[model samples]
Target: MIVSKVSKYNTLNDFLKSKTFMKIALSMTGCKNNRYELDQILRWAIKNKVPVVEESEADFAIINTCTVTSIADRKSRQLVRRTRNNNSGLKTIVFGCAARAQKKVFEEITEVDVLLGSMQEVITYLESNISDMKKCDDASLITSGEAFTRSRALVQIQDGCDNYCSYCIIASARGKSKNRPQKEIINEINKHVANGFNEVVLTGINIGAYGASLTTRPDENKFAELLEAIFEQTGIKKVRAGSLGPEFFNEKWYKVMQNPRFSRHLHLSIQSGSDSVLKRMRRNYTAGQVTDVIKKLRGISPDIAITADIIVGFPGETEAEFKETVQFVKKNRLAKTHIFPYSERQNTLAAKMEQVPVKLRRERVKKLQEVADICRSEFIKSQLGKKAEVLWEHSRLSGRAEGVTENYIRVRVMGARTAGSITSEVLTTENIDTLL
Candidate 1:
């Protein structure tokens, strides 16, 4: 069923409790924010003793969809069909951006039992259908610890986006910006700290615009204020920020970066480094503004990792414009760069513009990726012989552990180590694999 509006359920827990046990299979494709939401559902299932099973054995399937690109839409559809084929009797619930963006597409799918547009709708549906439901005793389950399988916890401080970038459909899919109260955010972080989670990632659709919609705060830099509050209120060892816009860097933000608790890595959402392309895309910041922010951040900590997301082959992007993006990425010496070849989204302004040829887009992606690889390798090499704080996540090989460093570098260490422990290590070439 297509969700037109959220029903009367007030809290997520109202839908979480059930008298009878059910097996669920969860699948998702999206950003970290979507992943965090999925994790919440997983945690709820765990707390209530619901069995999360494989697709073939599940009675119900929850599919969190993504519509960031045309391919994402295809994958989401494929997932629904595959799950149904795996078990014809399995009921499917489709939610998230893809279902929200193209409700008709999922409605056309005969296998989908529920098509929810938002988290509220998902909660309401569960509350109505699940019999003998009750509220969870531990309210802390709403925000605190992650799934038992995870080493780090993700706390979403905000949701939705207001920026109508020409190339992005997220605004239409996610709706307007909404900020979670600072008190709730602090409480969540404190809970994670007490749960032995060494790191907590602050995630959102447009995290840089965190406090723009809040009425209680008159401060222009509410995100900086939030960071200060977390630093002062919570004992979490490290706080990592999700993708942010260049405009987020200001004097207040710079001051907060000086705090040792803040992770020394920043992932700026720089869609295009070419000023002309950025103007056409309707991005708020220019190339110069991004450059200035990166310089300032590097100045604060010389070895700080600077990463970015670069969209190659935007509509009408000339060869010169693409070259400018290449030069910008190379000059910044970015620790890592997520490269995407622009894909047309229905109802987005960029879709109506002069389109870049598919072959040309692929070529540009390959060329830019080469530059990104070199930059990543150089950044990794720079960290060699330096001390890094790593939070071990898992171990694939016996007597060895793999983890991510504070600066977002992946490293594997020899000998026995616990998955949840944080330890300082001197990075050497032998310990760092995937150096490329």
Candidate 2:
């Protein structure tokens, strides 16, 4: 059987087209972009009458991988191997940033039958009989019509990044920044609303950078115009913006956030709290600027959830620099922080600089995490006794349905079914997960 399969499958396109229906498994190891890619692939498979199944019971496994950090790269490789090992005779296809940046690494795995860089490459590979997959490297982004979700719809309005932060590789892997047309974004949202998704999340690599390059008619704020259009055009009950950079904050955008249709929560990519660390990281905003932005947001809505990303120890960061970050977090009372220890990346400026010892980085990470835990508890405590809307997702806990609040807090409400979004009074802070 193995010999027969090998002889018949000289190319992936031929193998795919030969089958009327094949069971395939879809998996991703990274951010919302990967999730978006996976959904697009699933839609394409269904259009071709292919049935997607679990990795343990599949003829093919497609894994969207990440390479943000060394750990992420290692996990991406591990997952590809695991997918192949779990189901013998499984053909694996690896793609996304990890695959694009380190094609040779995936090629060496032997289990990866196809190494693709982008969604456009995956679609082209499936549609054509091209044998050389290497040529598909660095393929441009493709706009997805619909992402497969029943409750909350995530719309990718933009892709790629222009901000080449010192310790990052996404700019190279994903290529230059690009935005989907305003009309296309609106149409996609309408389709999801038609499919019964009440909540919509606008996501991208740098969503806050939307419409910067586009030709505006006259005196048009592109991001604001887009949001206003979504609110006026669709019946989507709740709209959420994805992780926006501190640089994207402006008076026009802030005014849009005041609209009742927009979600009260916002995630800013602060990267680091110390001005020195932020400058070293090539971040555009300082700790003070971030603080002022949050202050303005709070002034708009007192109960708003302002979350941020913070890297604990960058290269050459001193003890004083780390303390500055700690003080900043404590001073601003950030609702929650996505804390991560700085990881070195190859071919990046930070990687060539003086390295901070892993032991020290881990220590600082622990200290900051402890502070973050307190802030999260305080935020959740503040939410208690207030009536906020909860969009129930699934039954993760026993006798309770898990959902996220408008302010991005995950709470499990008793007897709350996973349906449309609803408003509920926060009775007790007990048993509610504090992590946002």
Candidate 3:
């Protein structure tokens, strides 16, 4: 059984093309991209008629991993050991951002049969090297690796980050930023659209800094123009962007917001609410500037679901600073907030800097989370009486079930069947999940 498989982010199912009967298991949740990685993997499995399993029930095991957090790095290492342990004889391969970030971690582990970095290189290396396991090095080579992803098909418009944000280890973990050929991006979108995906998300380490590394035209690397080309050329892929920093937003991109297909959701990284802390964390944008973007988004689309990431209790964050964050969130009417207590990661600038105690970080995270819940409650309640076009997804029962609206609201049903499923709009809204 010459089976082929990849870890979590292997979206295109490049390995599936092989003439092999292999059960594949992949997930995107490991790294937490703009789109769900596992969702894309499931879609690919369904399309190719391939079986994807949870543990080792087949010839091989692949893990696409993450290294954003210290915990994430540990999780990746744990999986490599577990996969081999469960199937003691199984051929296990570990790869992805985590693998790239912690090369030494892989080198230390004997369980990992093949170790590589990034989805693109992992695919290319596995294609040639997997046949004879011993010949491949513990650290796999990308060889000018180019790959798209499952989490909204992350077209890597750029890779790595140059911004030496004090707290961030990305500069060391993932190398310098590398941009992709704009033409190739268009081609990939066309292919995915042909395959039935209606949307595509642009992904990168420093997406805000795309096209800077180019030899052709540095000024031509404007994200707005890139988006213009994408929208004008193809109607198939709706532009669902991945992680976008404050540097990415401006008046020019604001004009592009007019496109209805563009998702209203914008995940801005407001790591710290305190202006002083922003400088310490080395985040490029100011608190005032981020608030301005939020305000602008509201003006353009009031219903737009604006999300943000807030790292509570950074080094030197005082009670007043935390309160400032709380006030800012309430004032701006944020739709969602991903709150993280600061962790002192090794080798990063933050680790060496004066640290915020873990207990303090936890307290700050909890307090901010409460603020987020209050805000989200308001948002959900607002949607209660309105109508939306949900995708009409599946259920765990005998018939079809609930799905999300374009704005990304999950409307579940006792069996709240959508409009097309049953000829009852009033019934659907009311929880009378009955079919007739």
Candidate 4:
């Protein structure tokens, strides 16, 4: 099941044009996974006007997928085959979390000529010399510098994870926590700034843990210092960081946030608000610590859009624990809550603990959704009258245009669409689409 051999210096642009005007198509599913990965590839496609044909019309389709859930895995498989059936002779590439999670069987798909994991490698493979693309499980190793779509590129400050959370298989699949050198990060940020990207988000498997293993215990290269250097040295106007953990919070982080250009967005992963559940899930922080951080962020910048990831229904989650989670959100008044039902990933701590019936998991998720809706309603109410910068995106509403507020809220405005332009601000609390 060996796919085509990718050459040593594969770049996505070079790969796409290697075949002479191939209509490349790509799609992504899931939360930040969607925004960070596919957004980069598609943005590249749009910028180059590289004949990135839509799913139905594509000659060579790429699926940058997810494996967060068994259901998500199903969707990835379905999409892979669907693309194959639709374009019978067309070449398809299936990579990303699901592809890795499901074994190297994707190379079995006769129609899919190439499968690369992680967005970082996928981009390189696309532009890489057609012969250099290696069909290996290590997507990151397929390294080649890409121009990205913009000058302000996401310099992956880190990659992989060490925490090994109970329900997540990311650590095993992606491997250990790996951080690019501080100087390397600064250089990339400088490159992005020089290219014209005013903002760069420090990204990785567990970004908040940056500098921990790199420096000695007493004189560490702190995450905060990394931020300071990125700002003071690189002069990148906006700095956003995450998949952060609550344990990483310290006053030094407060010092970094004092900078106005540091985006007031904190994406905290709160699997559940119940303490017993947190212990069972092996999450290091309690609900209170998470709240304290949220409150601190609000005090520092009230407009900060605080987002969270919550997984409901572990092995033996009871109604009381579920209620506690609901009450936790009610008290925290979270700006946004990403709700997920627990999925039993193979070879994880949770899968072996005990099984929560599928029906029960669904019910728990439904209840949490109810609570999340309540929290979102309260947060939106708080956002009533604020001026926020929004990045405009094309719309499905009328094939027109829309934009996203800094806190990640979508605000539909009256204007023509431009792909990457940051447009004017509206002095309204809620966006037009909210009412619709």
Candidate 5:
């Protein structure tokens, strides 16, 4: 049977084009960009009439991997191993940051059949191997117009990053920055709108560096200009941005915050609040600069939810530096914080510095997480009596519905609400929960 199958097809493409039916399963562990890529692959599979099934029953499995942190890397490897174990005959394909940055790690896995380093490679390989594959309409390599799930759609405006932060491996994994054309982005958003998606999140590896690569019509390529174009050109009701660096905030960005359609939540990628730590992290902005940006954002929208990503235990971080971070979180009254204990990545500058003890790193994470919880509760309490637009995402049988506000606040209401319906509700203690 094996000899017959081999003789029937000259290449993988021939087998794909043959009358044989194939099934595939997808798994991923990463950020929004990874999720977006997986969604694009799913769209392609659907277009080709490929059945998506469970890993145990699949002929092939695509694993979108991540290497942002040591934990993420471990998880990525474990996911691949578990998927391969599910079906011994399954062909496993690995891709994304981890596959590119730590190629040998995946290469050592005997279960992996193909390893793609980048989204372009993934797209090219699929297009070449799959017969009669439809090309994506947009200039970007990924397909568009499909909602990420049933609710909000993610529109990738850019990919990769040049900012080599001392502790980040993503820059190396993703390679140089690449910007999608503004018209392509706008058209993508319009497609999501027509598909019944009211919210579209503008996502990228480093969205702050959106237009750095575009030379022609430089004025139109600026990040703020892209935002303005989306507001004016697309029917998207709510536009949310992904994690942004301190450099993203400027006079132009401040002006765009005035738009009613723009989401009120901002997740700043300010790794540390201590200027010394910031310098060690090779961050361009200072602690004071981040404070100023937060203050200005509040001035523009008092009810805005300002969140941040903070690394707790970078190498050589002293108690004073950690306190500064805690104070900064308190002073700014951040609505939420995505906190991480520093994990040293090989080939990065910070990895060579004086290492913080694993125990200490975990301790710092706990302390800061406590503070973040308090700030989150305070922010939710402060929103009481304020009106908010809630996009219902989940409904229960007992006359209960849960959704997120424009400012990213999670709210639950006592009524039958259809998922995907946007409704205005006055936030009260009963409706808003401070747990998130």
Candidate 6:
């Protein structure tokens, strides 16, 4: 079952046609961008007629890992071991941020067949193994970074991050900011539209920083402008913008988001609610700036879903600073907040500072989490009797169809099937799912 040595197969086409079909298991743990990258590899396997199996049945396994936090790093390592242990005959190949950041960590594991830095390594591996492989013109269709659900597709418009937040390791792992050409992004979404995807989410490592390094002509669109162009030029009905920083929001931003085609939901990264913590974390925006942006966004769309990321216990964070965050969250009444307890990362400024005790960090996270729960509950309650356009993604065991609203609420349609997107009235809020 060990399919590591591809000498037996001449080409991918030949392997597909052979009696013994190779079983490849692909696993990913990280952000939307990482999922999109892994999806490309999955699509590639499907196009070449490779049989993808579960880890238990895998002949070879491909793991796309994350190392955004210490917990993520541990999980990535555990996943490597688990994959190998599941099938002793399976060959493990590791890639993505975790592998890039800790190459030596993966190299020491005897189970890993290959440690890769990028998707190009996978392409090279496949191409090298093939003898009589005929290059397919549509191969890029699979390789293009896109993750699809039944009615929605997440397209990676950009990759990597330039903002080296003091606690973040993404800069080291993902490297400098790089944008996919505007033409390429448009074309990819066109494909998604053609394939019956009702919605497309523009995702990236640092999405707001799009086109920072690119030399643009006077007429060309940058981040917000690019969004405007997409709405005007594309056949896409619903376009969901990705995670943006507070600095990205402005008059130009309001102009672009005014389009009805844009989703009312936005994920704004607000690392800390305290200006002092913000400064220590090297975040570009201040607490006051974040509040202003939220207030402005609400002015535009009163019911707009504004989710944020908040790091709870950074080094040197005092009780008053933590309380400042709580007050901010309560005041903003954010739709949702991702609360992460500070975890020290290597080669980061915050890591070298006076560390906060784990117990205190957890206590702050618990307090913040309670606030997040209340915020989420209030948002869902607000939508109790309203109607929303739902893109049905999956069917549940209880004869219910679950999907997400344009405003990012996870809704379950009772007795609904695998039907496409629909505009339906919200029946009840009794069974509303809550996550913090």
Give the candidate order by descending lDDT: 5, 1, 2, 6, 4, 3
* Model 6 stretches astray by more than 4 angstroms: 1-21, 132-148, 214-221
TM-score against truth, every candidate: 0.90, 0.90, 0.79, 0.80, 0.89, 0.89
Distance (Å) between predicted and true CA of 377, model 3?
Answer: 0.6
Which portions of model 4 miss their true places by more than 4 Å? 1-23, 30-59, 104-111, 115-153, 194-198, 214-221, 394-401, 417-424, 429-436
lDDT of 3 by residue, 262-380 (tens): 77677777787788889888776688988888888888888777778888878888889889899888887777888888866677777787777889989888888888889987776
lDDT, each prediction = 0.81, 0.78, 0.63, 0.68, 0.82, 0.77
- Candidate 2 stretches with Cα past 4 Å from truth are 1-20, 129-148, 214-221
- Deviation in angstroms for 264 in model 6? 1.4
Which prediction has the highest lDDT against the true structure?
Answer: 5
Q: Write candidate 6's Cα lDDT for 1-436 as tens digits.
A: 1233343233333544442445578887888887788777777776675556678867568888999999999999998988888888666778889999987777777677777888667655644543344433444333332343556778888888777888988988988778889888998889988877778889888777677772111112278878877887789889987788787666888888878788889898898999999999988778998999999888888878999989988999999999999999999999999999999999899999998899999999999999888988888788777767766777878898777777878777677655457565563664345422
Per-residue lDDT tens digits for candidate 2, residues 1-436, read 0111343347655666555445678898988878878887877765554556778767678889999888999999999888878886777767899998877777677677877788777777655532322221212222223455556877889888777889899887888788889999999889888877889888888887888762111122278879989989888888999898777678887888898878899988898889998889987678898889999999899999988888977999999999999988888888998888999888999999999999999999999989988988888888778877778776654678777788988877667575555656464666466556
Q: Which of 2 and 3 is the better model by TM-score?
A: 2
Q: Estimate the overall C-alpha local distance difference test score of candidate 1.
A: 0.81
**Which ten residues in a row are the worst by lDDT in model 4?**
136-145
Ranking according to TM-score, highest score first: 1, 2, 5, 6, 4, 3
